[model samples]
Target: MAGYIKSPFNYTGGKYKLLDQIMPLFPERIDNFIDLFSGGCNVGINVDAHCKKFIDYNDKLIDLLNVFKNYDLNEILIEIEGTIAMYELSNTSTFGYEYYNSNSSGGLADYNREKYMNLRKYYNNIKDNYDKFHKNVILYILIIYGFNNQIRFNKKGEFNIPVGKRDFNNRIKNNLIQFINKIKSSNCEFINLNFREIEPDYYKNSFIYADPPYLITNASYNEQGGWDEDCEYELYDQLDILSSRGVKFALSNVIENKGAKNEILVKWIYSRNYNIHYIDKNYNNSNYQIKDRSKKTIEVLITNY
Candidate 1:
C-alpha cells in the first residue's frame, strides 16, 4: 500500500497519475480484480497484493507480463543486462524497431499478430479463456529503448517504431528476482483478448477498470496502431453490458462521443446512469501547453447486484 510499482514499458494513456485516486475506490473485498484493458500494468503493480486476477487484453503488453511469469522474466532480465554490457545507452529512446522484430526468433511478431488479426476471432472463440503465453519481454524492452518507449504496429500488424531513440540499458534490473518477487505475490494474471467478447456474468464481485482508446479524429489507436469502427462499437456495447450486470466499472475516455466535442462524453455517460468524474489532465504524447490539456472523463457504474 506504500510502495511504487514500475513498468519498463512506455504505455500510452497510462493511469500512473490517477493511481492514488483509484486505490480508494477498489471494492473493500474482492474475489478477484481485473484491469481489463491493462496497457502498462501500472494499476496492476499498484493493486499488487490486493487483487488476484490481473487480466490484460494487449498481447504485447502481456507478452511483457509473461516475462514476469518467472521463467521468461529472469531470462529477459539477463538478456537485458547482456545486451547492455555489449553496448551502452540501453535506455535511449533513439533505437530502431527493425532491430528487434527482424532478428527476433519470430517471438515478438507472432505474439502481436495473435492479438491484431485474430483478436476479435479469438475473443469470440474462447471469449475469456487465456492460455497461450509468448516470451516477449525482450521485444518490449527493446521497443521501450527505442522511440520514446512507444509500442506500436502498422496497419499490417508490424512493429514500426524507429530505433536509437532511447537506450534501454539505462533501466537495468538492479535486482531482478526480487523485483519479480514483489508482484508475484499478487497472483497476477495476464489475458490477451478483445473487448467485444467479454461476458457480463464474469464480473460478479470483481473490480473492473477500463482505459479504452480515445475516440478522436483520425486517431489510429496509436500512431502505429489501428482501431476499427465495428470493434469500437463492440467495445462500447461490452461496457454498457458490464454496467447493467452490477459490475463495479470505471472507464477512462475522452469526452468526444458523437455530435458534441469532448462534452458529449459527459452527457452520454450520464444518460446511462453512470456517475462521471471529471479531471483536467495533460493529453499524453502532446507538447506541454495549457491548450494541450484536455478533460479526462472517468465514468463509474456501481450496483448491488
Candidate 2:
C-alpha cells in the first residue's frame, strides 16, 4: 500500500516497520542513498527524495520504476488487462502459463499469471535481453505482479509458483498513474546493476542498505534453488569494505534461532563487523513457527561514526 509500488510483495526480511528506527541510523546529509539488494524497494521509495542511485539486480524491478517514470501509466494497464483475463479459464485448459493451478490451494507457487507473460513478451519485443544492460524489467515485474509475489523456477527457467488469495491485475489505470507520478517527482535513478560492478567511490559517506539473501540451508520467500551462502559472505565482505570507506549502512536479517533456523554463517558474518545494533521485531506471514521464539531481531546497523 505504498504510494506508487505495492510495498514490494511482503518479503520475509522487508524493512517496512524498521524504516523508522533504521532511518535515524542512516547518516544524515548524504548526497545520495544506495539500496544494494533493493528487493521490495522500500529503501528506495522511502528515501527516494534524497537518493542519488536506487540500484538493484532485478530487471523487472527496474521496469516498475522505468515504466512508472517514463511510460504512459494508463496505456500500460489497458495493455495488461486484455492479456490478464486469459488466465481465468479452467485450470486444465490451454490458457497461458500465467493462470492459477486450480489446485495451488496453499503451496508456495504464487506465480502463474498476471504481468509476467507481458513482461517476457515486452522484453522479447524489445530485443535487448541479450545486451549488456540485460533490460528484463517485465520479467521481474511478472514475478512480483503475480498472485503471491513468489519468485521461483525449475531448471528450465519456467515459472511454476501457485496462486495466492487475490488478483493483482485488477488495479485500474488511475492507480498506476498516481504511483508513477509519485515516483517521477522524486529524485530517483534506477540502475540495473549489481554490487560487484559498482565503483569504489560510490560508498563515500553514503547509506548502503544491505538486505541480501540469508546465509541459510533453506530459502524463504518461496524462491526455489536459493542463492549460495558464499555470495552472502561476499556481500558481507563488501559491507565491511563500505564501512571502512566511511559509508553509513543498515542491514535487516535474521539474528536469532527459531529451531529450524541455520543462520550460523550470518552470525559469523555479522560478528566480524563493529557497531552492530539489535532490534526486536516479528516475522509475520512467515512459514516458520515463532511461538517458542521471539519474532524480534537485532537489525545490525553497521557504521563508522
Among all candidates shown, the one with the greatest lDDT: 2
lDDT of each: 0.54, 0.55
Q: Give candidate 2's error at residue 100 in angstroms.
A: 15
Candidate 1 lowest-lDDT run of ten: 296-305
lDDT of 1 by residue, 205-227 (tens): 67677776665533334344445
TM-score of each: 0.68, 0.68
Model 1 residue 18 lDDT score: 62
For candidate 2, the per-residue lDDT at 33 reads: 77
Predicted structure 1: lDDT: 0.54
Total backbone collisions, model 2: 13
TM-score for predicted model 2 compared with the true structure: 0.68
True lDDT of residue 138, candidate 2 = 39
